[model samples]
Target chain A: MYVILVYDIGEKRVGKMLKHCRKYLNWIQNSVFEGEITEVKLKEMVGEAKRIMREDEDSLIIFKSRDERWLDKQVIGQERMSTDHFL
Target chain B: MYVILVYDIGEKRVGKMLKHCRKYLNWIQNSVFEGEITEVKLKEMVGEAKRIMREDEDSLIIFKSRDERWLDKQVIGQERMSTDHFL
Candidate 1:
């Protein structure tokens, strides 16, 4: 599946979350990552995120689509980080 | 169409962007929003974003889908905002 993951983690643990997410997805912008991954990989990534997050203060949200084609993306202004490698 | 909008604006202008986006979509997380919106409304929102953004530093991205059913959302940890009004 293709996924866009966004997180708001406590300042202290955010670095760790960023590092872990980078291992599996493209870092598109601040606290946001997106890419394609198999179900097992997605599960693994979610598990790692759970470990890095503070249940009371941090939040992680994933928007999933069966295929990237179903999602139309538009960008306005500057492109901070490119996910063109996936293209 | 259902759209998930995310923006990375300069700190000084981010508040304006946030306020503008809220008028059209549901705030799902920090700098993240998602909900159904008409094509006309989407275009209007994009135009407003361009005006508020700095050509060299800010970015606004929109991920659009034909329908919300085509997108699946998963939230982990604390959800700072609820988007149930759209449901």
Candidate 2:
């Protein structure tokens, strides 16, 4: 499962979070840092992120997906998928 | 499962999201809106919230809890709990 984090932080603090993520996770980058990640590791990363972002009072969106399909489902609800022409 | 939405929206947009949530959920308040919510209803609220908060690129932390203990666990990691005096 992957951790989906959504927050609006100042440009500078974002840099800080990125630095910490790299130090802990090594070199990895996805469009939004998406990939296979365990809940423990994700929680660790989130803990570090909260430290940096706490000053700014940023909002967060962090969740573990049951699978790829569930993640996709949340991205686009069932209603939208039901009406898709490709299906 | 409950949806945990963490997004740092502008003061004005937060007001808007709160208004929408109240209308849709029919009066509910828990520090950070903790409770059971369907995926469909949450998707709708997030969709509307996005519209109001779009102006500010806010981060979000939205997740569905597998259970109450899991939620509590995330709030405090396993390592922390292992040393708990209460336990």
Clashing pairs counted in every model: 0, 12
The residue-level lDDT of candidate 2 at A15 comes to: 64
The CAPRI quality class of candidate 2 comes to: incorrect
Give per-model CA RMSD.
Answer: 4.0, 10.7
Please state the error at residue A66 of candidate 1 in Å.
0.5
Instruction: List, for all models, the DockQ compared with the true complex.
Output: 0.83, 0.09
- Tens digits of per-residue lDDT for model 1 on B1-87? 999888888899988888899999989888889899999999899988889889688878889999999999999987756544431
Candidate 1 ranges with C-alpha deviation above 4 Å: A82-87, B82-87
| lDDT (C-alpha) at residue B31 in model 2 | 13
Highest DockQ scorer: 1
| Model 2: lDDT of residue A23 | 45
lDDT of 2 by residue, B46-83 (tens): 77766766532443334455453343312221111112
lDDT of 1: 0.86
Q: What is candidate 2's DockQ?
A: 0.09
